[model samples]
Target chain A: MRVLGVDPGLTRCGLGVVDGAPGRPLRMAAVGVVRTAADDGVGARLVAIERGIEAWLDEHRPEAVAVERVFSQHNVRTVMGTAQASAVAILCASRRGLPVHLHTPSEVKAAVTGSGRADKAQVGAMVTRLLRLDAPPKPADAADALALAICHIWRGTATGRLQQAVAAHAHPRG
Target chain B: MRVLGVDPGLTRCGLGVVDGAPGRPLRMAAVGVVRTAADDGVGARLVAIERGIEAWLDEHRPEAVAVERVFSQHNVRTVMGTAQASAVAILCASRRGLPVHLHTPSEVKAAVTGSGRADKAQVGAMVTRLLRLDAPPKPADAADALALAICHIWRGTATGRLQQAVAAHAHPRG
Candidate 1:
């Protein structure tokens, strides 16, 4: 399955598409950052991010989209902006009828590096090795995005199947 | 000017449209809540909100859209949902090239009830009186939405003009 992961932010939104499944060789379809200036109005910045995500969705056409869930931060303003950007990414995917998954930072870290407390450098290095790339994706955000995609591919599919199993058990067909 | 105000929330997003200038009698054009099921996925909830906001914008065609600025709350999840919903409102307005304004709770309370710390009852009473409604809007969210629109009508226009003045002074055309 191809999954597009989004590291949502107001100033720089990271996006990466990965094609693969659990226990398989994963490949990077695309990776980039969508940047919005600090001076731009919040609405305008959101619009720009929306357009950028729309373009990526059109270009890569990933089967599922994974977005980083915005958790509470000390900086309320920053968290608000990040949450806003995250919502825009989810909206883009929903408009296209794509299933969207949200993964916490710790979840992505654990999935990629086998450690929830892994640092950025460790995660980046593991992503490079896993994708068999010469170097890690430029900008920490890009690497984080790739990690998210990988994590969702590894975890989301299993979770979906489990949910389906539960549903089927609850309402069995005759 | 006509303004559409949004009181962003996950379960019940309040939307209201009001028409008038700062000193004139304001008229209510529309008021309602966009409800989403709590059990729904976040992406589906956001998509529903987007569609609701789009419909409001298309029907009301307000000159500007006003959204409640999300404030830091003790409940992180609740705040995140509110911020996400607020972003959808802004995005809908931005897509339509309509100006978007964000008003704080204090700002709305002050504009509607003459006190920033006024309680919901006070604000609701003031909104009913200001809009000349037969009764206060059913839900508190709806009343808050109307208050936001009134606040923007009374304050946002003046703020916009002041911003224009500052910009023109910073960069003179001649």
Candidate 2:
């Protein structure tokens, strides 16, 4: 299955796509950033981001999506912007009924580097090693996104049946 | 000068335009929602929104842009979506070299209704009264956007020069 993962930010959003089964080597399909100018107002930058995502989605057409859930941080301003970026990713996935899977940063770190507290460089190094790539993912956001997708494949493949059963049990009426 | 105002939302976005001068009534040159299907995914919906804004800009050639700054709400999901939508407006204005203005919800209400705590209905009524329109702006977002534009005109026209002076004083080198 091809999965798209996104690390969203107001100025630059990281996107990566992986195609393969769980535990098996996943091929990197594409990776890039959706960039917006700093001088542009938040609204305009968002539009540009959206446009970039559209182009990416058209090119890749991943079957599923994984995104990092926004966590509360001490900085209100940063939290606010992150939340907004998260919403954009969610909206993009939900609108298409793409079945979005959200992962916490720690979970992604653990899945990628076998440690919950791995730094960005650590995670990037592991991603490169695991993927057997010559170099680490250039942009931190792109590496993070790739890690998120890989993590989803690892976790989702194992618990796929359990989750389906739980969903059936919980939403029996629906 | 002409100013465009936008209120971004998930399903719909409110848009309005007004002549950017004192004593001019807020003109509803166009008022409508930017609709996106619930199943369309964020990328496609965003394209629709950009097309809507681009069309408006091309048609009106507004010299400035104004948007309502988002305030935190209990619904995290909604707030996030709104922020992305706001980003679209900001990018549109910034790319055109037109100064973009952001007004808080309270400030917009106070400017239009003389009370910061005014409800939506009250603000809608006041917008109609102030603009001397034949009817209330349809789809609350449109009215809210119009109010934001009006707020900018009221505040910016009087103090825009003063603000420039103060900014220059604070950053002499800049």
Which is the leading candidate under lDDT? 1
DockQ for each numbered candidate: 0.80, 0.23
Proportion of native contacts found in each model?
0.80, 0.22
Q: Which 10 residues in a row give candidate 2 chain B its minimum summed lDDT?
A: B71-80
Instruction: Please tell me which predicted candidate would have the highest DockQ against the true structure.
Output: 1
lDDT of 1 by residue, A6-39 (tens): 9999999999999998878999999999999999
In order, the Cα lDDT scores of the candidates are 0.93, 0.78
For candidate 2, what is the lDDT? Answer: 0.78
Tens digits of per-residue lDDT for model 1 on B1-174? 999999999899999999999778999999999999999988899999998989888888899999999886659889999999999999989988899988889999998999999999999999999999999997999999999999999999899899999999999983
Give lDDT tens digits, candidate 2, residues A93-156.
Answer: 6656677787889999998889999999999999898777899987898898888888888876
Q: Which portions of model 1 show Cα errors greater than 4 Å?
A: A164-174, B164-174
Q: What is the TM-score of chain B alone in each candidate?
A: 0.94, 0.89
TM-score (all chains, Cα) for each model: 0.95, 0.72
Please write out the lDDT profile of model 2 over residues B41-159, one tens digit for every residue: 55566657766887888998877788878755546666656766776666667667678888888888888888999999999998888778888988999898788778888887767
Interface RMSD of each: 1.0, 4.6
**For each candidate, C-alpha RMSD in Å?**
1.7, 5.1
